[model samples]
Target chain A: MSARDDILGSVRRSLRRDRLSDEAQAALQRRIRAHERNIVPQRGSGSGAEIAARFIDEAKSVAVTVQPVASDAEVPDAIVRYLAQHNLPARVAMAPSAALEQIPWASRPTLEVRRGAARPDDQVSVTPAFAGIAETGTLMLTSGAETPTTLNLLPYDHVVVMRTSQIVGSYEDAWDLLRQSRSRADGLIDMPRTVNFITGPSRTGDIEQKILMGAHGPRRLHIVLIEDA
Target chain B: MESTSHRFKENAREGMANPSLQRAMENMRRGFPDKRLAAIGRLPEFDALRDRARDIKNHVLEHLDFYLEAWEAKVTAAGGHVHWCRDAEEARRTVLAICRRLEARTVTKGKSMIAEEIALNPFLEANGIEPIETDLGEYIIQIRNEPPSHIIAPAIHLTQDDIEKSFRASHRQLDPGRPLSEPHQLLDEARSLLRDKFIAADVGITGANFLIAETGSSVIVTNEGNGDLTQTLTKAHIVVTSLEKVVPTLEDAQTILRVLARSATGQDYSVYTTVSTGPRRPEDLDGPGEYHVVLLDNGRSRMLGTEFHDMLRCIRCGACMNHCPVYATVGGHAYGWVYPGPMGAVLTPSLIGVDEAGHLPNASTFCGKCESVCPMRIPLPRMMRHWREREFERHLSPAASRYGLGLWAFLAKRPRLYRLVNGLMARVLGLLGREHGGFRHLPLAGGWTGGRDMPAPEGEGFHQAWARKRRERTRAA
Candidate 1:
């Protein structure tokens, strides 16, 4: 047997010999069955930008800037311009996506774009969202070629770009999408393994429930809702 | 107070007598479960998420060795060291050795359950190293020379008035005449007192919520910025976490985080979720110089390949305790361990051995409120039963109880004998309790009858009454 199979075999054996009552064993099986049933298909459709706007409005209670992208090349220029307009530092963290890298920044001397890695002092980081849930204004970030988890968390400010088609109505719809995607993929559903649903910037009420922004993570969260990108 | 069992009884007695603690517990009993249900009610997919989370945890446990090695590689690549400890003693000794090597005189600590498991504070003090708890709740308990009663709300047992007195006594440098009544005033005093310790401490220790194997990072989510301050401002940063905290990716961590705060305190997300990849990079102006991640096995690894593997899925949300009827009445300290409530009942026995903590499992009313609210869906009652089974197998139970149970089980299995015995007992009880239809005293059942009267059987047993009713119906037809 393969190494994985060997280990699993031993686990199965050990579980069978365990001293649990028959009723307990049956109850556990039932719970597992119920869990399996939840992974089935569901129907939902919504616009990512509308979801993004609603989330940004509800979660942050602040004005948001929605940017539309025509070509991949314009992405970097748009980011640089936005940063420059805000008078932010030149360094920007970009997600590990082919589309993110396609942004032509060779001519922009002032802009220094780096690959997604956590640095203590990076001013702003940009990443693409795997999906966006309109229900709670949550950006569902998954680790893969398109988005790196580090870029979303490390910088002082985080800017997430969501395509309009990737929006879902609720968390259940999100799970259905994930389940379908994993079923289609080969070799045990290599799902990004980690999916982060970010609603707002890092905050703390620890110091006597006094609201403190940017306690340990990012201070500001900016969502760039892209339409027809 | 030698063993946990002894300390547990003492703490329980003290907690039961403390009126303020009783009041606080009553507030918690009403607040937490209601908020959690409301939070869960909003999300139809919460059940699905919990299932997914349980599966994710199971998958991790199944492949823990591979993942741990993978995580170690990532952490080492990111300029972090991962140390594997087999038990609490080893973990404490390793941590102390690290401090001794650095000649660390003062240490600042973020809230860590593993540190409590190892009894790290006392060990540090014995070694002449001063350790300060930075979390407000932990700091209060530290001043009072007590272990945390609750996992999240460590000093929940202490009232504001109690805190005022403790603050006045402890903050000697402050003006003796000033009135310290307000909550904010006490917080400000604590902040000022803890600020210098945060800045001056040589070593900072924390606990990990999730360890990213791919990135070699330790992630912590807290409301108070204390965790970040403790890690960033110190010269050395140490994270003590159980082996099960490792997750494969940040997305997985987020999925867990989504449930964590909602289960913990009804918040969608905690105030701060910090991910520390390594020590400060060369370009960084401020951060820890040396970063260490201590992965403690502490019976957890053995649990990975056992039936208790599901217990590893726990995120330490303490929902089970908040909703548990027994826990709400007695509070966490009554369990007499670092972990308490239903989760504690199962885990303490597993970690400390069933023989030592057999009473913990039996302390529950088995109402199943704990299982229903548990975000991880750990079958807490079933696990408690497992502990009971282990205790029985070892012949650790009292002889009188064992004999009673054995006889009862035998009679229960045989319906004829059970009915005959129960019928006779019921008639006797009815005759004795005709005055009030109840009894205040019963042989070998004083433990139950002591606090409240046992209602006598109304008439014949259910089976006998049913038979008589059927005979009368036949005669009428």
Candidate 2:
């Protein structure tokens, strides 16, 4: 017998069922289709400014540096200031997202911005987050033509420019937003090739349980939180 | 992958004796449990979430075949392939076949206990395909040519000095004067060295934290983001995970994720929780061109309706081991396999066989700490007892233990005889040990007294003391 058949057959024998009953199949399908939420944490379940404040607090606790920009126009100046503070380079690989591309990089003459996917040598990369989860201060990033996944993984310093309005109270809220936005004709959510929920810069406690940041990904994660409604 | 599990007593002795291993285990004992408690304390819904997570897994396991079929259809719909393997040999061959077709010379791998279970690196290297572990812990152990001592912390048995020595010996390009005193410096060295390998690797393999049947998405939770780098940069991404990892939907996966990171490393969320749906889409500029999921059974199917079925609910959080006294004392290597501690005690026997791994179950003290901390609420002590019973029934237990139990069983059938023998023995031992308050040596219990003194029994037997107490109470009334 084929491995698949043999394995399935064994499982069936153990379960004492020859095949899935019509009722059983329907129930299982219903469970998948419903995709119900279970016990969302109350800590990040607040709304409005509370969620944003909670997000910043949680983010800062994990050693993420959050800069609350007053508006979208202030993003460029904020990035420059952050880079200068961290002693990072003027060069950055920016994602081609409309929100990021609209930023007036021309105003900053000293900054060198390369658009599209990040190169291996790129020291800093700026990408727009799809959402910010308030529960864990996680940035929800999706891979696309505009937001190349490499921009999230290949750089030493990662700058995420997300608005306060983009921050959700919980992971379930974020999932609901995704399902609403990307529902296909078949009713299944058309997920991106990759959806990364990044809470902080990459870290490793592998060596003697001493946490050292930037093991394989970004060493510094700078969030320019634009206070936009 | 070889079973030193049979010689668990000897392995445990060496594990305890090794100064470095003892030091590493001490750090683990101090670190994981406290952090987990703090993480869970932050969330009021932690226990409720764990309950829901257990229910979801139980539901999935019950309808596993149905979910597997549904998940496969979804995977194919999303332009991915699903390979089914009955055993480790088939799983290894399936991975090799994929690499051969891709003409992959070097493969970058994320941390996978499944890979360790199959001994993938050696097999791939023998086939002239180099497999590089990208996770920091796995990387350290890989270079050292040693199996992971801990599941989550693979090189938890090694010290910073050991890592520095390994790097210096293997990385000949390193300057003699370069500072390697700090963990940061070691991390940076590995990061820079592995970056080129990540870029150069033709195939990238990873293990799935959970496979969603809803959208054919495979979820990976990692603190270091090596998994993301491994899967994204390569031409093909091969996920070598067991069949039991599948959940019904993304929401179900999320419920498990809520408890997973907290239980594993005390993080509310890992630094990176990435969900990959098949290969990269047509419009995607990055990610792998091909996606394959190798669904490995390897004896899990037989565990479906058995007494050990709850063992499948493990999410590999390592919480059970973290809280286990036996694990804290001897460390992960003493269990002698890819998995360790209470989970391994129950699971190794089922996967490898009780005959080969009988000593693992016997290694536990039935402390029940592992069960209390287990997110799935797996009755670990009960399963270990089951294994002991199985061993005794099959006569796989040592003759000494069987004979001792046989003598107790024989005497216990007759209460008068049992009481007479016990009363005499207790008085004799109590009188003998009145000075030291314990025995330094014993005839039948050499194993118990080998390491520490066994406390002496009281002078009177339990029945004699109980009768005396009852008579005194009646007279007073």
Candidate 3:
């Protein structure tokens, strides 16, 4: 017998069942299809503005820098200012998302921005988030031609622009949004190649349990929150 | 991978004596439990979530075969492959096949204990392939040529000075005077040294925190994001994980994730929780072109429906060890295997065999802290007791202990003789210890009184004291 059959057979013997009954199979299928939620925390529940405020506060608590701006047009200016303040280069590897491309980057002629996936040579990368979860101060990013997962990982400085309206109260809300998009009437979520939930800058407590940031990922995570846009 | 579990007593003595190991163990004992308490303190529903997490795992284990089959179909549908490996040798061979097929000369690996279980690094090096461990902790141990003493904090056994010495010796190309004194500097050095490896490795291997059947997703819970870099930059991504990690859906994954990070590191959530569905999609700009899941069943299926079946619910959180008194003193390496602590004590016997690892189950103080902190609510002490019983049944216990238990059992059955002997012994000990009230040493209990004194029995036997009290009460009435 194949290793698969041998192992499964052992499991069946141990479980004292030759095979799954029809009722058991049907119940499991229903649970998978329903994808029911269990005991989601109440910490993320509030009004939109309140949730956004909580997002900023919670994000800051986890060592994330959040800058709430008035419009999408100010995002370029905000990035420019943040880079200048940190004494970084005025360059970015911007994602090829339409939402990011529509930003008025032409207004800032001095800034050098390239649109593509992250490069080893790229010092900074700006990627648009699919959603912001306020409960844990997390940014949910999807992989695609536009988002291209590397932007969130390879850059030294990562600047994410998330609209206040896109910020939800919990991970459940974000997952629900993902499930609703492109479902084939079977309640199955057509997940992207990858969905990354990033809470803060990359860190490690490996060395004698001392937390050191910038370990093989971004050193600084700056969120340019577009509020009242 | 060799069993030093039989030499646990000696290993524990050395572990406690080493200044560096003691210092590291002290830090864990002081920090982790308090941090877990504070993290859970903020969430009122933390205990309820643990219950839900237990139910979810119990459901999965009951229908493990069905879930694994369903998950394999979904993985194949998503343009990936699943290899069923019965043991460590098969798992190693399967990984080698994938690497040879890809012509992989350099393999970048994330932190996976399954790799440790198979002893993959040496096997790869012998086969003329270089395997670079990318997690900061794993990298530290890799340089030092040591197995991880702790699962999560692989380098916790080493002091900062130790790391500085290893870095200087390993990275000879870097300037010797680069002020590599601080943890941040050490981290920066590793980050730069490994960035090129991420780009250069032909294949990347990682362990899954959870494998979802609904969307064919393998979730990685990390704080440093090196696993993401290791997988995303490689041409092919291979997941070296076990069968018990499979969950039924994304929602079930979320339920476990809610409790996992909090229990492990006192974090509300790990920094990066990435769920990979398959290889890079057609429209995706960058990701691995190939994806493979090696589902290892190394002795886990046989453990099902036994006294030790609940051991499969382990999420590798490291909390049980964090709160285990035996672990706090001996550290992880003394358990002498891939796993350690209360979980290891129970699991090692079942996986390796009680005869080889019988001492591990006997190393516990039965403080019940491990069970109290366990997110999956595994009865760790109860399972350890089961191992002891199995050892006794097999005549694997020491002759002295067997004879002692035999004597006690014989005496316990005769109540009249038991009380008479007990009264005589208590009177003798009471007279002997009247001056000091304790004994510094004893005849057969040298192991017990080797380090400390044993308190003497007080006054009369229990039956005599009860009778005297009853007569005095009657006279007063």
Candidate 4:
């Protein structure tokens, strides 16, 4: 017998059953398909304006800087201002999302914006978030032709562009947004190669329980919020 | 890994006597519990979420076989390979086979207790492949040639000076004269050192926090984004996890994730929660080319429907240990296994054997703190009692304790004789120790009172006092 058969057989014997009955299987399948949310805390729920305020507060608490822009057209200027404020280099590796590309990179001749997955040499990178979870100040980025997972990890400084309308109050709402964004004939879309929920810049408290940032991922995560997307 | 659980008593004694270990453990005693309580205070529905979390795990375990089958199908549909291994040997071989096929020279790893269970690093090194631990804590302990003392924080046992020493010894190229006093200085050193490993690695392996059966995703929750870099930059990504990690859907996974970091590190949510479904899609610009999962069922299949079946509900949050008084004193290495503390006391036996780990169950003081704080609400104290019973049944306990228990059982059956014997002995002891009020030592009970004085039995026995009070109350009425 194969390893799978042997292991499953032992599990069956331990559970004292031949197999799951049709009714049991159907109930489980239905639950999976429905994907019902359970017991989401009311803490994250509020008006959209309240959520946006809470998102900034929570994100700041975790050491992420949030900058608000009046519109998508203003994102490039906000990012450039942030770069200049931090005295960081003007070079950035931008994820190849259509939403991000529409921001005229040529408008800023001083900014060298390379579009693709981040290289080790890149000091900063900007990626468009699929959704923003206000509950924990998390940016949800999905891997695809547009946004590679590498764009979120390799760079030292990460600037995420999230539209104000894309922010959800809770993780459950974030999942809902993911499902609605990509509508197939079926309710579910196969998960992209990776769905990353990055809350704050990378940190570790391993050494004597002292908080230290910039362990392996980005040292600084700056949020460029498009208020009028 | 190799279990020194049989040497628990000696190890615990040495752990208590060591000044450095005691100092480190003091920080944990204050840190974990206080932060968890404060975090719990912020969330009004923390208890309710814990109940829902327990229910989700119970439901999944009841239909584990079916869910495993479903997960396997989804993984295949997503173009990922799933390998089922019945034992640690098979699991190790399965991983090595993947590495050999890809001609991987070096493999970078995220923190995984399952890798420790199979002793995978040594096994891979023996087969001409180098395995690197990427997490800061795991990397610290790996350099020192020590197993992780704590699950969530592997390097908690070490001080900054300890890390500086290890780095100086291991990183010969670096200047040893540089100041490395602060935490950030140490973190910066490790980050620069491991970045090359992440890029040069051929394969990346991580342990799954939860395996989603609905979408075929292996989710990892980490504060550092090293796990993402390890998997994304490599040619192949492998998830080495056990059978019990699977939950029914993304929603169910979220329910447990809600309680996981809050209970462990007192964070609302970890910095990074990444879900990897499979290898990169055809249109994707960057990701691994191959995705493989080796599902090990070493002794977990047998744990289902047993006295310790609830052990599988654990999410490795380390709350049980944080709250356990006995664990607070002795620390993790004393348990001498991949797991430590209250969870280890119950799980070590089931994974290894009762005979090897019998001392762990008996080591507890039955504080019930572990059960009260357990997010899964596993009856940890009840299971420890079961292990003790199993040990007694197998005649594994010492002979003197057995005879003492046998005498107590004899008296317990004869209530009248028990009361007479107890009253006379109490009166005699009360008279004998009238002046001193306590005894420094007593015959046969020397072992119990070795640490401190045993208070002398004073006044009438409990039954006599209760009877007299009852009679007086009845007369007054």
Candidate 5:
């Protein structure tokens, strides 16, 4: 027998059963399909403004800098000001998503914006997040043609552009959004190749249990939160 | 990987005497538990979530074969391959075959206890594949040629000076005078040094925190982004995880994640939780072109339906060890395997046999702190007792312990004789130690009295005192 059959057979013998009956399999399938939420924390549940506020506060507490902009047009200026404030280079490896294309990068002529996956030498990256999780101040980014997963890593600095409308109260809410957004006509969930829930800049407490930021990933995580979506 | 576990007493003695290891453990005891308390304090639903997490795992374990088959179908549909390995050797062979097929020279790895269990690095190096550990803690220990001292914090046994010395010796090309004073400077050096390896590696190997059977995705939770970089930059990505990691759906994964980081590092959430479903799509700009999942059993399947079955609920949070008195004192290395602490005490014997790893179960104090703090609520103390019972039943326990237990059983069954002998001994010891109120040395209890004086018994034994107290209470009533 193959290793798969041998292992599965052993599991069945240990579990005291052969292949599960049809009724049992159906019940298991139903549980997975239901995708029920268990004990969603009360902390992140609130109105739109309240949820967005909590998201910002939670993000800030974890050492991520959050800037609330009034509109999409303000994003370019926000990025430019943030770069200048931090003394970072004006060059950015921006994700070429349709939502990000709405921003007026031309207004910031001094900035060198390269729209593609981040390169090995890229110092900074700017990507539009799919959603902001209010519970833990996490940004949800999915891999796709326009948004390469590399931009989320490899770079020393990561600047995420998100809107208040994209903020969700919990991780369960984010999963619901993902399922609804990616549901196919055949009733299957076309899950993304990769989904990253990044809460803060990369850090490690490996050496003497001392926390240090920028360990093999972005050191600085700056969020440009658009207030008026 | 090698079992020095039979010499646990000596290993623990060495561990306790090592000043640097003691200092490092002191820092960990001060840091991890308090942070976990604060993190859990912020969420009112934390305990409720733990219960939900435990139930979800229980449900999956009962129907594990069903879930694995379902998960295999999802992975196949997503264009990913799943390999089933019965033990460590097959697991290693499967991984090496994939790497060889990809023509991989150098592979970058994220921190994985499973990788340590299989001893993948040595196997790969022997096969001419250079495996570079990407997690900072793993990198530090890997260069020093040591196994992870702690599951989450691999270099928790080392001091900052040790790391600086290791870096100086390994990265000899760099300037010798460069300041490595602060932790950030070390981080910067490692970041720059590893950046090239991440970009140039042919394959990336990582362990899964949870495998979502619903989406056929492997989830990796880490503080550093090395896991992301490892999977994204390499041409092929391989997940080497065990059977128990699989959960039924994304929601199930979320329920467990809610408690994972808070228990592990006291964070509301880890810095990065990345879920990878399969290989990169045709439209994708950058990701691993090939993806494979290796499911390892390694005696775990046999653990099912046994007394040790509850050990499968472990999330590798390190909370049990963080709060374990034995772990806090002797640190992780003394348990002498890939796992350590309360969890390791119960698990080591099951994986490595009761004879070889029997001493680990005897190392616990059974204070019940581990079970109280366990997010999965595994009855860790009870499980350790079970291992002890198994050892005794198999005659794997030492001759002295067996003789001691035989005497105990004999005395315990004869209550009248036991109380009579106890009273006589108490009276004699009480009179003999009237001056000091304790014995400086004893005949048979040299091990107990070696470190400190053993307190003498009171004038009256426990039975006499209890009988007098009861009579007084009856008279008062």
Candidate 6:
């Protein structure tokens, strides 16, 4: 027999042996039914830009800065200008999303755009979040064609350009959105196998309760809140 | 070997004396719970997810026989071996026999609590095969000859200075005067040291976070990626886990994962979530040639048909510990044994017998904080009460305690006599405490007064106070 078939057969035998009494089974089923009915819906209001600004203020980082995306036409230019003002060299990494590509860069000096691999010192990396949760200021990033999970962790400074339309109030709202998006495609929502919820920059207090940033992951996070992008 | 009771007292004394550990614990107490609350607050569906996760665990436990059988079949089909041991001794024997067959000399372990439960390291060493603990925290404790203090953190009690001191004493070829002060330096030193051992070790052993019944796979989640490297590099891979770790499907595992990291370290997920289905396939590269899983029963089967069965739903998240006032003060080692805190208080009694571990149940203040934060929502205090009942049934209570309880029961059964006796005692106690309205010492209450003074009760008890108030109201009306 194949490995899968053998596993299934074993499961059947084990289940028969360990099956609970009829009364207990029925009680458990009722409990599960009650649980499903009482599940709460996620939050509904708040734009991505507003959510980003709130998170930045709450983070209270001395080094990191938060700024609003000027316009859809000038989003890329604004990011470039911010990096230049901070005296950081401009060799930015871009996510393969249409929203990211739509940033008008044809008239500007050729910015080196690399794919697949990332370096530690890379000045800026721009990625579009799948959804932004307004409740706790979390960016929900899922692995897909447009946004690879690697872009978020690879650079020194990360610029998460979240559109106002994609902002949700809670995780449940994000899941609802994801489930709806998945049902449209054949194999989209089988659980991306991985969904990362990044709250803030990487930090540790292992040394005498001294808060040190950039212990392992990115030290600085720059969230560009795009209005109606 | 040091008994868990002895270890508990030793660790408690050390914890009480160590000011640095106290300060560290104080910080952790506020940090973990606050972050968890913030995280849960953001996710409106967190309650729903918790409920779903609990249901999934319950379903798996009810049909555990089926899943275990299925797992065995799949594992066997994939050229892996499965052993079911009814107790710890049997489990130890099975592991030893496997090592003997392979003539294994050295075994490198990847932070397995189950292995500690079986006392695998001492058993291996007694049989002449050296066992090395490869996890950084485990390695430090192994050198110092100390048991792990915490489940997840392990060395949470130790400061960087303590670690440096240990390294200075142990590392033969090291600059004694050099300042060894960075987390990365310590991590790098451990990585270099363990990297060689990982390659040369005859066997690799680990514990499972969840065993997937659908695929006969064992899943391990680790932050350092050490578990992955340990299993992949070794010729043989062995998983030692209790029967309760099994879940029916990958979806169920995912639901559990959603809460697991959040409860443990406030992470969405650990760095690596690995699923190893039996030995490496013929076409696979850099994987173990032989795979084995030992499913330990060890009193767990007996717990299934008892009231304590809900305790099996625990995923070992340590949330109960994080929120526990006693654990926050004394830390994990105080409870003594493989498991600690509220979960440990309930579990140790069953695994080690009520007579040997009866004190654990009574250690709680019944503050209900543990149950409130428990992701599985296992009523921990209630379970501890069940163990206390068992201890009473076994006639394990002290003679004085039994006599006191007997007298109290007699009085309780006869309300008139109880009221008269209590009234007399209250009047006498009230007169004695009239000066200060409290006592520094009380007869037959040494334990209560040993550390602190007890506040004197009011002149009237609740029943008398209530009755007089009612009479006054009726007269006015």
Candidate 5 lDDT, A1-229, residue by residue in tens? 9999999999999999989999989998888888787788898699988888899999999999999889988989999999989888999999999999999899889999999999988988999999999999999999999999999988889999988999999998998898889998876689888999999999999987788898877999999989874
On DockQ, the stronger of 2 and 3 is 2
TM-score (all chains, Cα) for each model: 0.74, 0.98, 0.97, 0.98, 0.99, 0.73
Query: Each model's C-alpha lDDT?
Result: 0.72, 0.92, 0.89, 0.90, 0.92, 0.70
Candidate 3 chain B — worst ten consecutive residues by lDDT sum? Answer: B443-452
Q: Higher-lDDT candidate among 3 and 4?
A: 4
For A1-229, candidate 6 gives per-residue lDDT tens digits of 6433333344445444534567865564344223222233333345655654554453333234556665677676777776787677776877777877777766466556654323434657787778765544566775555565446654557778766677676555666676677543432233342244555654444443344554334557777766664
Ten contiguous residues with the weakest lDDT in model 6 chain B:
B1-10
Candidate 3: tens digits of C-alpha lDDT, residues A58-169: 8887889999899978988999999999999999999999989878999999899999989897889999999999888999999998989999999989999889989998
Docking class of 1: incorrect
TM-score of chain B of 4: 0.97
What is the Å distance of residue A170 in model 5 from its true position? 0.4
In candidate 5 the C-alpha lDDT for residue A161 amounts to 93
Tens-digit lDDT string for candidate 1 (B1-477): 124753555666677787887977877777667777777776666777787778778777765655666678777876878777777787888789888888999999999999999899999999999999988878988888988878887877666788888888888889988877866667667766786787689999999899976467788877655776788667889999987898776556656776887898776556556667777766443567788987787777557656577899999998988888877778788888788888998898888878778888888888998998888889999989888888899998778789899999999999999999888887888787888889889899876686568998866777888898999999999
TM-score of chain A of each: 0.70, 0.97, 0.97, 0.96, 0.97, 0.73
User: Tens digit of lDDT per residue, candidate 3, span B101-217?
Assistant: 999999999999898888889888888889999999899889888888877777777888889999999999999989989889999999988999999999999999999988888
- The window of 10 residues in a row where model 2 chain A has the poorest summed lDDT is A38-47
**Top model number, lDDT:** 5
- Candidate 1 wrongly placed segments (more than 4 Å): A1-48, A60-229, B1-3, B6-10, B465-477
| DockQ agreement of candidate 4 with the native complex | 0.88
Q: What is the lDDT of residue A188 in candidate 2?
A: 83
Q: What is the lDDT of residue B170 in candidate 6?
A: 83
Backbone clash pairs for candidate 1 read A55-A137, A194-B251, A194-B252, A195-B251, A195-B252, A203-B271, B75-B216
The DockQ figures for the candidates are 0.09, 0.89, 0.86, 0.88, 0.91, 0.10
- Model 3 misplaced stretches (Cα beyond 4 Å): B434-437, B460-477
- Report the alpha-carbon TM-score of model 4 versus the true structure: 0.98
The positional error of residue A163 in candidate 5, measured at the CA in angstroms, is: 0.6
Task: Please estimate how well model 1 matches the true structure, expressed as its whole-model Cα lDDT.
Answer: 0.72
